[model samples]
Target: MALASALAIGLLISAPGTSHGAGPRDVAGTRHAAGTHHLASEPGSPRTVSTGWSVPWGLSWLPDGSALLTERDAFKVYTLTRDGTKRQVGEVPNVVTTSGEGGLLSIAVSPSWNADHYVYVMHTAAEGNRIARMTFDGSALADYKVVVDGIRKNTYHNGGRIKFGPDGYLYATTGDARTPDLAQDRTSLNGKILRMTPEGKPAPGNPFHSLVYSYGHRNPQGITWDAQGRLWEGELGDQTYDELNLIEPGKNYGWPRCEGSCSTSGMTDPKRQWPVAEASPSAVAYADGAIYMAALRGERLWRIPVDGASAGTPKAYYAHTYGRLRTVESVPGTKSLWLTTTNADNSGEGEPGSDTVFQIDLT
Candidate 1:
């Protein structure tokens, strides 16, 4: 459980698109390593934590172990306690939704929240998508300041997930903004995993001499660090594939050029890949020696085991049982995971406030 260098580079394996227990059959003709396989039983069911939510998008814990949660279209932030009590804290101002995906998206309580009382959020503004900071006194929010901006926005592809890494630096995921070529452009902030200081400046030792930590991502929406401080990401691919990548500084995850696994030189392959039909992944959380990826189109939670740099076969849980999983987050000091549904979102076809949050206890 030692922490690795934040800038260290590593490689992961490739896996096929398979739904282990429920829904549909495994996708054939997808390229993967020989040893990648599936398990038979499904993970246990989750206990409902709360209900009546409308598109809850992000969840991050405060110093006291309670979590701060965000609603995408409402521009509202709420605090959820351990006993299932939910209270509205504040609403992010100047936020605009694309009527599709953009709005108040991700939240991360500053690592030094005890001293700084700072909270950060990624949201869509009039000009573009922004990473902003504000004061959270454990009771209310105030004093907003824009830390990072200029990430282009689109109706559907505005990638938005942010977390403070084990290195104490801020890391964010971004989409290509519907422009495929931008994923390959190192200069563009779109389609990249960015590591930055709390003040929005590029972190030291970044490969590109800029904020970009890794490039060539299509619409990456999930990122988390393992017990060893290795970063993992989940992305939405085009028509063919979705990706679960073991992130490394300076590496390029093939996007427009390669969908899943390809022999193309210089572009890194994913630790696991799934057909777009089986995995439109959103948020990923690391817990109990595995990465739990929340799937949208697949409507399942994928648990992929990890050992150092290698990823094992993915196992699916709660397939089609909880309409459109959106986010999965590890509880700070427990063997539990908090999961959210996106059933109230535009693509879900459910009534507003139909979304819910659940706690999945790992054995």
Candidate 2:
């Protein structure tokens, strides 16, 4: 067993059914039936939508039901039709695919895409990680413009996940980039959740009076908003724990000082934490009153039931059946979800043409 798994065994035996005082709750505001244990049976099976991708990473749906997908090591973006036909949009300009984890990471369609034809992307460049905008003219991509730059980047821990929130502001997740101190530095954009405008300016009413909306994160990847407009994040821990955090403006999620939960002043505790072997969670999506988290190392999809500000014990699906799940995107106007796998990447099992996109119907 891993160190985290051993630690969790001792902790569970000592505490029995509690989790650092705050545990997931059910719809009736009652304690979860499964208590603090994160293990649960698979809910349902997911249907394959597309396959044969090389490290597919990001996924975003367009207004016309077509979806945009990104390949991390390939540094390429493609549009996928409902029938699974893919057309290469273009390669992001100047993307550097490192041997480690940094590369073309995420894509976010502009809120005004119909009029502006703008699509934003986050990728690793020669200097560092950056967010850029390009015009997608239905068939091709052009008019490349750098929006945000100077975010630190290392071989790993780039934390490259970006999305447009319901509030019409762009939210991006950044990692410590191997520099842990940068997480605590308000002046640095590393290890922060940034809220910005469509024009790349800091969103008004940002908690830090800068681009940072939340700080002190290790390597947060998945970010999504609840029905109540509250932001939640999925974070990877360093050999100790994996966290699901309820993000709040200006809140400091304890990083180097604390891995899971701490008594430190001004540090926010995670709503749920699991052993790293069970959850190296990636992109998350909220649908049907639950948060769906895609796991990479753990090789599963976690379903955490949500009720207002509380979350319920998480259930696992497709554990080890499919390898290295990357991102989970909720389909608009339906109870279905889109998930992508990263088996073709270096860290994964690297099955031949094994990278695939799947559709899961929640109803």
Candidate 3:
């Protein structure tokens, strides 16, 4: 595996609580058209809330406002109430998760979850890294099947983010799995974002006519759609920098060959980047024209303003105070965000707890 330290073999900069990219308006919810939105900064302190978990990663808010969170080590998804009460929904099927960054990773509500009650998960299945759908009947699940399989695997770099895009299709992010060369291989699912249907087939009209929606990624964990339906993603870079990018379906995002800002003539460049040591970005939330990030090593929530396709400077908050942040979800019907921490990670810096969830008011 190409170590993040390997990328830092040369002159690598390190700081904490910084990241790079965002949307249409700005942080104050001002509009570019009406001039209401403007750039937002984390000048004020973030009000933190403790979730109380063991290594939380991805989280999805159910229709009833309950949440479902995945744990990388536990290989289980826990259902929690608004008050943070917890219950073990069930275990991820067919996973060994024995070392090397493989395990139960991320979860997404079926775009049709309201009707079908299906939840999709991305995990290190025994068959390999794969995507699967399981039905949650409030207490337990009965139907679980592999929707998509055959991603590369390794001890680390198992990019395992999954979400339902605004287009009503399923999208997944993959890690290079230490196979830098595979990132350049379109035929390989490693290091790419795949777009698929509910049944796991490639979405129709895809540029590749295959599962790949975009390629040339290292290991991306954060992905969200802007109010305008444009897809943006947060990525972790090796030695040099960490990044946030405006995604274009089918675009190549210069990974192993390029880390921070892409200067290669044809490859896409990140909208923003930070020196590695300080920030290891994990998840993102796009709200009111600003992108909110959860950082693992940097241990803060980063705010980046979006003017359009490009982004402005980034601001950081709660540095070294929140431990290792894993995921940031924009709470529906509110200006606040739902933030989850990752103190239990074997690579983290502190003691473990419930991994706390914060309801932070962007206002």
Candidate 4:
């Protein structure tokens, strides 16, 4: 077991209308089921589930409960079971690394996988970033088809995470691609949360009449649906603040115009904001009435209790224990989470194959 760090840092949660500076410890009207920020199934000590991974970026479970995992730099995919058995399932084709953040990234299994064996992926390619679909029968992957393309790609901000929302539409997060202006342009796919059909068409009922579900995002990497099927997102701010936003369709999350919280009309503010030093959040997963956010630079896990549209005080866990966390996914049907590390990547501090996945049982 990895040891938790001795440095336990306390961070005040920033309110939506507050200034860029830090706010009080708790948001005024936030409510919790347990009358506090802690979850009933509080996270226990982590158990190492698997090892020998290099920059594992995305994870999605098969109908059988075995998960499909992706290695960012290597363009490979593997199937990992709860028993810690792992096997290479396939390798994504035509995936090119930006030598930075780009490569084969997030993957999502078809919600109706038993009927249709389709798996979706978002990766950086030669022309740009593309959301593609492939056939994953049980053991291998094939039949590569591009679902959406033309998303801009830069070395650092290729915001790559995809999921099939409770509404049965595919949702993807794209970065600003180093050009912050693209965030505000609804025509561009970059810096937007895109909602699309399983075939890559724009999802019906979308506010913009296009794939753009919500616009004006800087580098949003994490997206998840709460118990009420409400969407939530985690975005990486440039220098000042990182955000945990309650996502709404057609809303504008001010990027170049506003970083954390601003009085800018028509722009939606984050539910909670944190200093960039504490959260370069890569992925978020909802389980047991809270959202588990995996931190990259912060090297920790954050648990934020949620009640409807309001968020409570944020709590840090496993601080500095794992090197650089890249992904956190709630284990379906259980009060547990599967967490991955990105320490093998360029910005991380560990060597190749130094990353591992831990199963954190919530007690």
Candidate 5:
């Protein structure tokens, strides 16, 4: 696929209730000619909600419009109100942040959170990468329990994104931990997408009859379902390409054998591929028939329109305007997306206290 044409437009930068850094500028909606399906060029600026975060990695929304956020290096969780008031919830115990990309990564509030009050987190521990459950009492997180463990961990490629599917099952993406061969080893938990119950058991009807749902991933950090309940993933590749894949049951996404796309039999090709420098894509979210992907190395937001299982050409937005976007999530019951920046980390161009969260309107 060819790169989408760039539109020179202006955006309105806004910061609500806080006077700090600038938000996205040059807000213009992409316009398409009649009956044409193309990437959108209208990219609007987001509103800065909060700042002063240290490599914030995960974001999950509570029932009452509050958000739970995790800081990767700090091993701390915070609750941010809609008005941008942030309060420290609690620190995750025994988290190992020594490794480069290892630390507190992703968070998911249970579908039955109102009743169970359970919040799930994926973090790096002394043994390896693990998923743990903690109880949230509207104030703090307690009763930390390790739900799943033994995922390989390394300085990089500890694929750390977790979310609940529309079917109410928990899904996790794991890296090969720099061991590329592990991506092909289905028996190993690394380099694959795992579907399991909230209790850490394999979800029934999984294609492999094991925890592995799909294998042959390098380091997939983003997973979200489209309106048709089909899963989409954003993957980080080696030096060649970054991929946006449509995930299927028991399928193999060619990793070591193929980076982006190949004619190899039985290996699923990516729906879209971009150069590594253009898209070290991280977390993704679906909203209004399009998948929004946050790019770290690219330092931009990508919006790809999805029709059924196929994706159209992707358009880049906010390119290099913000340093290192880490997560993008759709706000439930609204046409908004919550984006978090990962500038405080080693790979970013931000200062010590330079991470932030922004609210973007897609309407």
Candidate 6:
């Protein structure tokens, strides 16, 4: 429950903003469904689900409309109530937890969470960051299988996020693990967004034969799609600029060799860029002809409009106010965007359980 502060004050709320009104206003802000955004579900003013979880990450709308959340530091994925009661659904195996960044990271519901009941996850496994599919039978996971395993591992840049594209193929984002050279290496999975079949094989018709859809990324944590089916990603820069890249098949993003908009031969340029201090974006989702980014270091939520592959100026909201927003998700099939907080991370602000899941009222 954050009060509506002036845009400037919102940016500074990262410092435990003094309560101008009462304690945490229970306002849903304004309606975000209209204006060129896609609407997933038209229900109410916007709801905040789950109260106690710290460092909430991945998010997606269920077929039934109940959203799913991932907590990077909690070790388990809980089925959160729209009104904020978290119920543990399952635990991720081989989750190597530390500090700064780590743990049960991202989860993607199967194209058929209702029937197939499978939910895919990307986490730091024993070998490295891997993707797994688990079947949740309402209260718990009935089966867990490591569909893809043994990716390169580095501490700082694990790049653990997974999403299923509209083409029914799986797309994953990997980090450079602080190793600049790996980003340019086609053979390596780090610092790249991979496209694979549901069975984990390289997607047919992909630029490369081995699931390397796009490469040369630093640390892409967020992955989304546009109405035209163009794949988009949010890349975290080490010390320079965070990027919003239009992920194309087999294209290179020029990691260590280039940062923002570079015209290196055969290398791809980011559609948008922000200094690391202003937007350490983790996840991104599209709506209203725009892509909203969840900032971890900047402690803000950034929005950028996309026209085909190009992007416009950033529209920032909940600036220091939400502390640290880790993931912004456009609830599937709708215009509602779920904005979750990461204020509980080691480098974040607020108490351990101050994070909340918010839904944007589209209509």
* Model 2, C-alpha of 94: deviation from truth (Å): 0.8
lDDT by residue for model 2 (1-363), tens:
011211111000011121121223222222224334332222334566787888889988787988999999888899997678998989888899768889999999998889989999999999999999999988898988998999999998899999999899999999999999899998999999999998889999999789999999999999987766789999998988888889989999988787887789988888878788878999988776677888899887777876666777676766676778888887776556788888888874886466888776553
Q: Local distance difference test, per candidate?
A: 0.84, 0.80, 0.75, 0.84, 0.83, 0.71
How displaced is residue 191 in candidate 6, in Å?
1.1
Which stretch of 10 consecutive residues in model 4 shows the poorest summed lDDT? 7-16
How far residue 247's Cα lies from its native spot in candidate 4, in Å, is: 0.5
Q: Sort by TM-score, best first: what order?
A: 1, 4, 5, 2, 3, 6
All candidates: TM-score: 0.91, 0.88, 0.86, 0.91, 0.90, 0.85
lDDT of 3 by residue, 1-363 (tens): 111221111100113333322222122221223223365323222344434577878788787867788888888888876555788889887876847468888899876776898999999976679998999877876588999999978888888999888788999999999889888899999999999999999999788999999899998888987666778898888887788888997888998888866558768878777766557889888766677777887876777766667665566766777678888887666555677877777774545564666665543
Cα lDDT for residue 145, model 1?
98
Global lDDT of model 2: 0.80
252-342: candidate 1 lDDT, tens digit per residue: 8998899888889998988788988878999998776677889999988887776778777777776776778898887766667788898
Clashing pairs in 1: none
| Alpha-carbon shift of residue 1 in model 6 (angstroms) | 31
Expressed as tens digits, the lDDT of each residue in 156-235 for candidate 5 is 99999999998999999999999999999999999999999999999999998989999999999999887667999999
Runs in model 6 lying further than 4 Å from the true structure = 1-47, 332-334
**Tens-digit per-residue lDDT, 157-190, candidate 4:** 8999999998999999999999999999999999
Tell me how many clashing residue pairs each candidate has. Answer: 0, 0, 15, 0, 6, 10
Which regions of candidate 2 are displaced past 4 Å?
1-43
